[model samples]
Target: MPPRWPRTPDRNDPAFRRLEDFINFALHAAIYLAVNSGLWFFQLLNHPWDNLSIVSGVWLLGLVSHGCYVFILADYRRIEAAAQGNWQQELATELEEDATVTPDEAPSSPEQP
Candidate 1:
């Protein structure tokens, strides 16, 4: 079946794209929690504590895996880190070059009339 909402045409808008990702992730996590809540409620009255523990443990694993992807595997994070590293290097080079440039090569500031 086709998607309920048509595919977005303005894929270049970074803000919209990121908000879409956030919404998608929130929906999935909400569904997971809703299901787990139901499961735990049903099992609480009759099942052993050990059985309930298993259900919670498995759900915790799912959350941790999702968090790892969002925090580490996301491409934007790597790109941001790379950009920051390059900026730091450029600042260092400029500072070093300024300190080493001889008075003859340095451009003089314009004097006020």
Candidate 2:
């Protein structure tokens, strides 16, 4: 079964972004394996094709690059920290706005009979 997120999937979510990147890389690798294996099998059976190595080599490079980005280069911790900072700033701003409310703007309580 495919994985499910606890909440709605948003690009801003650091964990979601990291998982999505890994899923994409996994899909890419699976496709590369399936297609390249087929190509190599056929080539070996019917004599080697000149361009087959070139195609596989280029595709391998792309797969490696994707893996590198997903596993090594992605900064999920930094993203999460930035998101937390933004949330705290928003909370502080809301508290500040609430503190500035004048008596006329504030909600009134019901009068006792």
Best lDDT goes to which candidate? Answer: 2
Candidate 1 structure lDDT: 0.65
Tens digit of per-residue lDDT, candidate 1, span 11-78: 34444445566667777689878987887887777765566677777877887787676656655533
Instruction: Let me know the TM-score candidate 2 reaches against the reference structure.
Output: 0.68
User: Backbone collision count in every prediction?
Assistant: 0, 0
The models' CA-based lDDT, in order, is 0.65, 0.87
Which regions of candidate 2 fall more than 4 Å away from where they truly are? 85-113
User: How high is the lDDT of residue 101 in model 1?
Assistant: 62
User: Model 1 Cα RMSD, Å?
Assistant: 11.7
**Alpha carbon RMSD to native, model 2:** 16.1
Candidate 1 has its poorest 10 consecutive residues by lDDT at 75-84
Q: What TM-scores do the predictions have?
A: 0.45, 0.68
Where's the lowest-lDDT run of ten residues in candidate 2? 81-90
What is the lDDT for 50 in model 1? 64
1-111: candidate 2 lDDT, tens digit per residue: 966789989887898999889989999999999999999999989877899999999999999999999999987866775667776666677689989866686677899
Candidate achieving the largest TM-score: 2
